[model samples]
Target: MQIPLSQPDITQKEIDAVTEVMTSGTLSIGSRILEFEQKVAAICQRRYAVGVSSGTAGLHAAMVAAGIGPGDEVITTPFSFVASANCILYVGAKPVFVDINTKTLNIDTTLVEAAITPRTKAIVAVEAFGHPGGMVEIEQIARRNELILIEDCCEGFGGFAGDRPIGSFGRAGVFGFYPNKQITTGEGGMIVTDDDRFADVCRALRNQGREGMAWLAHQRLGYNYRLSEIQAAIGSVQCDRLEEILENRRRVAQMYMTRLLDNRFLILPTITDDVHMSWFVFVVRLNDLFGPTERDEIIKGLRASGVGSNNYFPPIHLQPYIAGPYGFKEGDFPRCEFVAGRTLALPFYGKMTELQVDHVVAVLNEQLEKVQMVRKPRI
Candidate 1:
């Protein structure tokens, strides 16, 4: 009866892969990591992939490699996870927030070029909730503006925009392997690119800047962002089964759509016709009539019924730390804030059952009715 928000689909194959790595005793900077990287690069249709400790680490590395230093501005959406913008700050660059398209829930492409100043160095584009809308157009914008495009594909894997894979659209793209993701590597991530120099720079950065020039020689400041061999082993197995994993997730998403698509109180995610979603988390938004307070009550009610749920993201611009420093306030990006306020991420995993899906939808409907009753106008 306790339905958790997300579960990693780990099979015996993944367990065995990890066991093999443990038995080998080469836990760091070993063959497994290389194999994992190669598999990811292949899947993403990129020439290089550098494994890192986490997606945040990958993003920071990409920003550093792109030479995004102090006073440089990186345009990005306020709708994404904070790491997308925080990566800009990590490299001493300022994040320029753009409002999201209400339909796509991604940065509004039409406004991107207008946001570009001479100081703008890059665009950190995110594939929100595994939907790949406007990514191609964003890449085109970056190219015309001579800006580095860093695709934060952490929430999107095995998805495509037009004919190109999600990670292949940018100069460099990052993917996360958190337990709740499409695949799990315990805690790992990757930076993928076609540029050899950028790949080498990231490899050096991930390993304390030891560019194989000397084992102990430090060429520049770096971090211990390397992924462990054990994590890579699990990741490699997950990659081996990537297609199957994607299919299962797609099925789970379909089940949710079938049950909730017609509900007037909810606004389900909008995926473009050309893109095949890889369903990171099944998030549904309460209609505009219902604000955050009512959304919160439904979440509370869901939790009481043992059905897990959460707000997928709060507006990154509105986070006190970001807002206080950047002078951001309400109405700066109303679309992102509106969606952020009402989004509810439901229990989602590759192996989620139809019965579980039905139960969740039923509980959600009941909660919505209760809220509507309480907020009804005096008659």
Candidate 2:
């Protein structure tokens, strides 16, 4: 009866795609990878897509192709996975940390401009948990200040803002095909863009800097970050079922909302009126009204009840890796630091059953009662 945090919804279609690749004896890169790139580009409405080794590699390649080098700084939020900041460092540029809007968990666009310096070269914004950031405002700022904008859409594949798709709003957008993401290919990622020259640079950098169409031409520095046709086949197959995947996730999220609708003490997530969510990971925050003790207790109790649960993130700023190096102490980014401590990620996958949702909610309520009893003064 244990509910795992996430599981890929692989189907016969996925197996057949992989079988076709194996049967062809072209297991590396060829037609399948090409088709994957085409399909992803079409999904994002971009002119090109390059399949890379992983999301980290896609981000690193985007930085390199965009000419982010030493002595430069890239402005980004500190509430995401480390790769967002590490990509800047991969190209010898420093990551300038910005705080996030506690609600959306997205970068605070209002604070972006003051962080810009003569050394700042780019803005790397992540669409946290499959929700688009305030891209319109971010884009306006980038254009006025003359900076490269990279959309870290690793968690927001099918998400959009208004009539525009997320990744297409910036100079380049990166996505991951890791198992927990919108789609799965075991291990894969992509870089999408409307600029042909940037796409060519990335393709060259992925292989071995061989701009020459022939395999032997080594024109610039590069790495072996190409995705195998096996993975490409899986990505193509999964891409075909993405709409179903997204719909299932969305439905599960709605169920949780209806079941766990607590107005007084639990801050349930609500998708903003216009922004569409891909529902990568359903999350909730404990309001202060619940008191400080309930947060950790509820998370522990949920796990004990066979309901898989984990914290959203520990704020990249406070992470041990960056804390000392960047001189980030507790109060640096209050919202990010506070949310990191109280937010919990509940189990909400495409295959989770309604009964499991009920069990999870019950466990949470029991924990809240236990914590309240502990805080009550003895009469």
Candidate 3:
């Protein structure tokens, strides 16, 4: 009865693809990797895509390619995974974090322009929990300011904002393919962009800074961030099935929404009009009346009842590594702190059944009732 939080949807097609790669003599820097890149680029409607070891590596390469280096400032959201901000630090720059919108759980566009300064080199906009809310406006702001916009689409693979795809909006977008994502490659990422020069730089950076296919000619200092041919083979198959996977995830999200819509103690995710959501994880927030302690107790109760759940994200700015260096304290970004404290990521995946979804909802409500009882004033 124990339901895990997330699972990748792997079919026999992926198995065959990987097995074929195993038979092939060339395991790395092979045709499969090139095919994977082309598939990702076509999906994003971008001119180029570079497969990398991970999303973090792609982000680092993107910043470096953009010439964002020492003494520069990159505006980003504090509510995202730490890597969103850490990437800026990787390129020897500072991350100027703005608060997020409580509804979309993405960066607040209204606050973005004010955060920009002469030192600002880029804006790293993350589609938190796979929600793309202010991306278009953020892109506009970046263009107006002549700054680079790096869309961190790590949680948003098959998502779309209006007619444009998630990775097609920014100067360069990065997508992660961890086991829990919409599509997975075991461990890999893709860097999507229309700029050929940026694509070339990323390709070189991911392969030990080589200028071309030649392995020995080192052009610049770079890390070993190349995605393996075996991983690419799996990713290519996953790309082919992206639409089906996205539809299944959307159905699961709808199921959760239908059950939790009327619950007074919970707040569901926000989906804007004209945006096609790619549900990465089904995260719901406990209402303001309940705080973090109560939320944690509810999660504990669910786990005790053989249900799996987790806090999807802790505020990036509040992490010890950033807090000490950036002088960030409590109340710096109240909305982000507020949302982060109460988020509970329930079991979610493309293959999840209605029975399992119902069981999770039942468990969640039972635990919530217990917390409510304890909080009641015993007059």
| Residue 57 alpha-carbon offset, candidate 2, angstroms | 0.8
- What is the per-residue lDDT of model 1 for residues 1-379, given as tens digits with 9 covering 90 to 100? 8899999999999989878988997999899999999999999899999999999999999999988999999999999889999999888889999999988889999999999999998999999987889999999999998888999999997888878888998799999999999988989899999999999999999999988868799887899999999999999999999999999999999999988989999998887678878889999999978989999999999999999999978999999999999999999999898889999999999999999999999999999999989878832
Candidate 2 to native Cα RMSD, angstroms:
1.8
- Please provide TM-scores, in order, for all candidate models, with all chains considered together: 0.98, 0.96, 0.98
Tens digit per residue, CA lDDT, model 2, 266-355: 788757777887788888888765533467777888888887888877788777877888788888888787777778888878888888
- The parts of candidate 3 lying over 4 Å away from their true place are none
> CA lDDT of 19 in candidate 2?
92
Clashing pairs in 1: none
Q: What is the C-alpha lDDT of each candidate?
A: 0.92, 0.86, 0.92
Where is model 1 poorest over a 10-residue stretch in terms of lDDT?
370-379
Ten-residue region with minimum lDDT total, candidate 2? 287-296
Tens digits of lDDT, candidate 3, 193-239: 99999999998889888987676999998879999999999999999
Model 1 accuracy (lDDT, Cα)? 0.92
- Pitting candidate 2 against candidate 3, the one with the higher TM-score is 3
- Model 3 TM-score is 0.98
